[model samples]
Target: MECIKCKKEIPDESVFCMYCGKKQAPAVHGVKKRGNGQGTVYKMPSGTWAAEITLGYYMQDGKRKRKKSRKYGFRTKKEAVEYIATLKQSPKKEKFITMFQLWELFQTKKETLSKSKRTAYNIAWKKIHAEIEYRQIDELTVPELQAITDKYGTSYYTKRDIKNLLSHLYQIAIRDDYTDKNRAQFIQLPELQSQEREVMTKQEIELLWNDYQKEPSAITAQMLTMLYTGIRPGELLTIKVENINLDEQYMIGGIKTTKGKNRKIIIPDKIKPLLSWLMETGKKGLIAYYPSDVEFYDAWKQKRSQLNIRDVITPYCCRHTYITRLTTLKVSPAMLQELAGHEDYDTTLEYTHLSIAERLQEVNRLD
Candidate 1:
């Protein structure tokens, strides 16, 4: 027998060809009962036939090899023909890789990434993995990834992180020959607004410092650190006691930038007394810290309400206050850049917001 499509040679009794895997034509035969009670069958063209050879036996090496053939078991000749025709038309099932397998690949590749990269990858993985953990790799579509970006909204940084994770996963798949192309290659991230630095006024600073004197607690120390060092509230909250150097008057370690880079900052004179008090209190390992940024913001709101202060003041306002004070003291832009650990001088300048009166005075001078 020969395969219809590939014309590969196959045994007359065989249902599928060994070379092309194509199903062969069914045998036109009927079953017969042997004297020994075993069933004997033979392929006969168009009619019934008397035969000594059983359909199951094939002569090989001058020996009769008896095999249990399923094609011979069909009750009717029509059913046997239909079964063979169905087998010929059926498509082969393709293997599907699970999401768990893809995640394992993601983890192995993520180990080679930098600390910052690993953090971003982990964050993105957590977000996507929540939805697709039970889905197959082939089941993941572009629309599902786009939905994730839509859910996160205009925070393009998070969307970029998610896209980056997908890109890495696709790269792993390509390297392993699991996929021919990366689907996430063409995803566009939305433009994010740069955070505007809001500097507090001298009067606002005086009000906060005076209010701190009245309370003189851990919050006061936290506020002082922000004002003196120009460190972000998130960075300050994570500060440990060991990271500070009272003798050198500096925060030596445990301060991470928004971009996830680590750096040291010099503590100014304004926070010197506050740092001294915190150190003298003998808190061994962890710094005496209060709540997080969100918590602090809530407390700040309540404090504002109590003080009857109409101005908007945030914990970050301390950083603004410090930058404004530096500009007022006529500190060089280079020195400000160094103190703020800013890569760009323009970023340091943004922190130096001049008052409306000062702006008017400069304009009047030009007139």
Candidate 2:
């Protein structure tokens, strides 16, 4: 048998063409003639004789054109007659929409997303959009999504972000009827183990602090601020002198390029004198006194190596230390959430790590 659409030879029993997915028309069993010099009607191999209409028209360029088309397929001649009576009611092939169209639809609705979510969406698009942009929406199989995930690798949180963006794309496609089904629904994410929370010991903090005092670089001030306040190192880098009120002992600023809700942190008495000194001698902006977060982190790493502190605590450890101490002090969950600028309590909870000594103290108190 040959497919009518593509004229490709197919196996005798094949219902759909392998190349084009077109349903093959059964062989003609008989022929008939219609009035007004229309095309001949043939009895389909399925025992149905239907009119194969040929319409003639002049093209826009003045060329004559003849188009032959079939109306319906039926198992019986009577069914064919009935189908011909309502020929206009037959369903048409759905338009083929591409992944790029769906992406455009997603982009159109991106304004409704949060700024961070928008950034995440764009980042994901940047990674794999080019590879699949021209593909039909129905062609985006689970394996393709998996391949993208594998290609991007596990580090840098890009896979997670891409998954989220793809999920949203699928959702939008379904809602808009662009696709009857989402192939990406079955796509699996690489099972990423949660990052081990970096924590700083009291001795380690003291050693780092001592090293900072000796070196007194911008990293030293940044590290001290991170330990004193539980703010993220990225947030620490954005803190301005105007954001800090030394008399009130709190640093008020927006978090992480304004991704987080605006929040304030109470300065610890231990770091109050240091903050006051910075405030007095500090430049017009940036209270933490670092040129950049990268600079601060790199300098801190160098100092850690110099001090030979094998644990190698990151600046983030100070944020964890603050949360740990706050947990020990029995701060309320709501307050802690607000202090950490976490919209969700679960995120704030991840920072809470109780030391063995503190755990033992709590156990003794239980008695």
Candidate 3:
């Protein structure tokens, strides 16, 4: 065929005449040839329209190369055209990378997390990558994100971690303008089961105390402190040698939130000797001393496993047992609340549990 403008012979398959840059009529086969810098639009196998454009390329030895970029899953051909138009307007788009690569970049740029927390995030990251590493982070939809989370939502802790990690990733994405909204934000974690905490029995407590007396470590001191003081495990991490007053035989503030629980708690004669021995260790800070103060619970957990007591109670149950013992002794409710470091009087009430034997003993005493 001849180009009408240039009077030059054009290839039968060409949509635009190469010599004159004029649009040619469609060949008998109805196929059109695409030109340079002009993008291609096609229907994907998944029944969605897609568009691609040749963006400027990286410079090599001496050759000009074209880099073709694609945007996927547009519902309509018009949408694909608009997408290409948007790409054309952009001076340069961020190079397309897998979600896992973005995560690696994210790790490098973000501030550090605590050691254990970093370990947990790494675990979560590996699990997430195994599921969706091949997928592009920028193009992820809400349903796609929800599906990923829902698949691993069986474990409560894991679900929380996945949501947190996803939010972090999307926050980075939004900051970099890779995405407009954090699709992970709308993913709700499944409701956790309300498993009741089991408090230590008198026999179990005796066993633990005897073990502590037999083989003492920082872990032993932390557990015994929780049992005696009813301090939250976290609050115990903040205990300093200065917080203990041997002269007054009381402890000062370690409670979080407010300074109200900073009152002098009369040190029981029972645990005072142990506290004195620990104080004699002369640790500058944190009486419940571990090399890593933040990992108190982990050390305590490892110690508990080593001891292998018959009934395994959580560290929080130490607070429960303390409150129960105080109730058994008929201590003042207001005083008990203060001792337990409870913010509410009602919260203190929930900790007190009277056994059948104790109730019967009380009834007999009433007669």
Candidate 4:
């Protein structure tokens, strides 16, 4: 054979001229070449096969760049060919890593996390998982995540949890090259709303005692138990009858955090009769068995309305009243912190909702 352009001698089986690099007029037999950008399958030095495909293109450095993906370690050329064929037929898909996937990764890497903290993360993820669990974390913007957090979050604590979850997921995504930036870092959580803490007034406490004396029902007992013991409304519902120690004057029940979990709550002399009555009535089951927190709260609301108590007095105010009483009695800060199951002394102080008049009375005593 002769080179078509240069008229130089070349091998007869050549597909292109050796000297001029021009295509021969007659095509080669029994050999096929993939078209440009269609992708390629070839044998490797290790005797495995590889397949590659052009995914898309982008402009970089003032030049057009072709983005391609490759897969190696195929044992046979046929497997490589089939794989590349599937890639060519399907629409090009980006490497999408969902927020839920990142969550799984985060959980796997965080082995030393406390059980309570892990539970908190599970709860926080559940709030927004349905909306963005399947969406790629890299595609999510700060505003989008913020909107999701705002929509699903019910309280300052819940919103904080959602923000913390997002921040953690973004951390994993950035570390693994899924994304270069953590958009969660840019998200701003709204400040916690400051409201005047309300506790049951002395008059209100007299009213509850009078009302309970009149009725003497289990519901009345339930309210008085929380009022005297400072048991959280949620914790009150979760208490088992067996956990109540009438002779010992304490019960083992709390939840939500390390400091708050399984802590002993003292059964005050004021509420001991109420607790005993509740134990006998509930009969070894949950002391206050309303299926959910909402139901229990609704019952509390009904009880309040029936008793004609102040509208501002929520169930939480019962716990507040207990703490305020302890503070007024000059309980040491250390004892208050332990009794209230507060991790911080400051948190125990926050629970004491002393009236301005009471504060002024103490201030005047100093003079």
Which candidate comes out best when scored by TM-score?
Answer: 3
Please say which candidate is ahead in TM-score: 3 or 4. 3
lDDT of 1 by residue, 1-367 (tens): 7787688776677878888777777754455444552334444554533223222223346554543323444555455544544433323211233454677767776788654567666767777775655454555677776786567534788898888777777777667665677777767777777775566655656766787778765665666678888887766666677778877877854344452246667887767887777666634454544433445566667766666655456777777778778887879988887787777888778778788887787689874
Which of the two candidates, 1 or 3, achieves a greater lDDT against the reference?
3
Better of 1 and 4 by TM-score: 4
Write the number of the candidate with greater lDDT, choosing between 2 and 3: 3
lDDT of candidate 2 over 177-200, digit per residue (tens): 657776666767666777767777
Global CA lDDT computed for model 2: 0.69
Per-model TM values vs. the true structure: 0.55, 0.51, 0.64, 0.56
Which ranking of candidates, highest TM-score first? 3, 4, 1, 2
lDDT of 4 by residue, 1-367 (tens): 7888999999986889878789888642322258885678877767788888865444456555555677899999889888987776554433446676688889785566754356567778887887776667766778898898889888887888788878888888778777788787776778888876688877878877887788776667788888888999778877898888889999999977799999999987877887887888784497887644556667777888987888888888888888999999999999999889999999888888777888998999984
Q: How accurate is candidate 1 locally (lDDT)?
A: 0.64
Query: Candidate 2: where are CA atoms >4 Å away?
Result: 1-119, 155-157, 171-180, 190-196, 207-220, 232-242, 253-263, 269-316, 326-352, 357-367
lDDT of each: 0.64, 0.69, 0.72, 0.78
Better of 2 and 4 by TM-score: 4
Return the top candidate by lDDT: 4
TM-score of the candidate numbered 1? 0.55
In model 4, what are the clashing residue pairs, if there are any?
A: none
- Worst 10-residue lDDT window, candidate 3: 25-34
Model 1 bad stretches (over 4 Å):
1-95, 104-126, 201-220, 232-240, 253-264, 277-320, 342-347, 363-367
